[model samples]
Target: MQDNYQALKEAGAEVYSVSVDTHFVHKAWHDNSERISKLEYTMISDSNKELARELDILDESGKALRATFVLDPENVIQTVEINADGIGRKADVNINKIKAGKYIASHPGEACPAKWEEEGDDVLTPGLDLVGKL
Candidate 1:
């Protein structure tokens, strides 16, 4: 996801990474990890598990579950995805969802269907006449 940070930012969404590690540990890892050494987004430290508990993603082992949250400009959560350990997330999927969310926010009452791609053409505006048509 760090690799696609520019694309996400261009799509008008800020990216932040929250981890249960302390600031010192995070800094050390960030400085050492070759893959993430150039990460440009903000990294939030949740060593106390405050954010994890608030999001209800803390596990019995006191570790946060892998999760992603897309929030709108108003700070309201628009989409959320949680995964178990050993699972991974795709940046393209989240980016597409962010695009769809932004589109829906700008064009109220319209809905983007499954696998909706910003360039690909699939949007729905519901009405009584369209009932049971899909």
Candidate 2:
């Protein structure tokens, strides 16, 4: 998560992380890790699990499920991913989608697809020509 966070920071995006853990534990994790010290974003305290439950990203054990949400600059949710309990969350994927959303929204006449890249097509034009390609 920290590694992918650095990538997002490099891409001119602000990254915020939330955890179901207690504030003390979160602080301990931050204190124990040198990499986390360099992070510029907020690591939110969701000990009550309000955010996870609200997002429907909470597990039966009351822990935050591995999930991601991409929000446009205006804070509209653009894309979301909720992973299975056994699967790990790939922060890179979320960062990429956030980047894509930023790029598409700014450029207009554009949309992204599964695992999109920078050179990928800007989709959803008035004509259906780019639909299949995207």
Candidate 3:
């Protein structure tokens, strides 16, 4: 996601990465790894397992699982995705999800359809019977 940081920010999203590694490990990777070195977002150390425990992402050895949490402005979790080891994440897909979330937030009573990618994309609205209650 480092490569798409600017795009994510432009989409009105703030990204924070939490890891089970120590602060020192985070710093070392940031200093030595080219990709990590280019990261511009915050990286939090969860070595004490505080966040991992709360999130219930701990593994057998106490390692945090790979997870993505999309939260609303009120800090309420809107969506969550957890992947097994070796699986990957896609920034563009997440960008679309964020866009759809923003659109839904503003356009009450309407919901984005499957494969919705942007603000002008097609959305699903309630029937006359449901009206604003949708």
Candidate 4:
């Protein structure tokens, strides 16, 4: 995750990590895990799960599911990924999605769909007028 965070940083994007763990546990985890300790992004501790609730990351079991949100510069949620506990979590994919978004943003008349790739055809401005074209 930190690796991806660093990549995003290199790309001139802001990144942050929010955890449901308490500040003490979050601190302990950071202190114990050498990998996470060197992170440049801010690690947010939400022991009360305020952010988890707001983001709807918590499942019916009352446990926060592994989730990811990609927000645009305006803080608008552009992508959301949530999964059951079995799936665990990975930040690389989300980082790639962010990269795709950045590319689309820079190119203007473009947008990415699920599982987008660099070479995929971006939506042209005129194509947008054809929305619902089957």
Q: Rate the local accuracy (lDDT) of all candidates.
A: 0.88, 0.75, 0.87, 0.76
Query: Which is the leading candidate under lDDT?
Result: 1
Query: Could you give the C-alpha RMSD of every candidate to the true structure, in order shown?
Result: 1.8, 3.0, 3.5, 3.4
At residue 118, candidate 3 shows an lDDT of 80
Q: Residue 73's C-alpha lDDT in candidate 2?
A: 69
Give the count of colliding residue pairs in each prediction.
Answer: 0, 0, 0, 0
lDDT of 1: 0.88
Candidate 1: tens digits of C-alpha lDDT, residues 3-23: 789989888888999999999
lDDT per residue as tens, model 4, 1-134: 77677777766577767777877887897899988788888888877888899988877866788777888889999889888879977777776677788888788766666566554555444475668862
Model 1 stretches astray by more than 4 angstroms: 127-134
- Candidate 3 wrong stretches, greater than 4 Å: 126-134
Which pairs of residues clash in candidate 1, taking residues 3 or more apart in a chain or in different chains?
A: none
Q: Which pairs of residues collide in candidate 3?
A: none
Best by TM-score: 1
Q: Model 4, residue 99: displacement in angstroms?
A: 2.5
How does each model score on TM-score?
0.91, 0.75, 0.90, 0.75
Model 2, 29-100: lDDT tens digits are: 789988777666788889988888989888787778877777776778888878786987767776677677
Off by over 4 Å in 4: 113-134
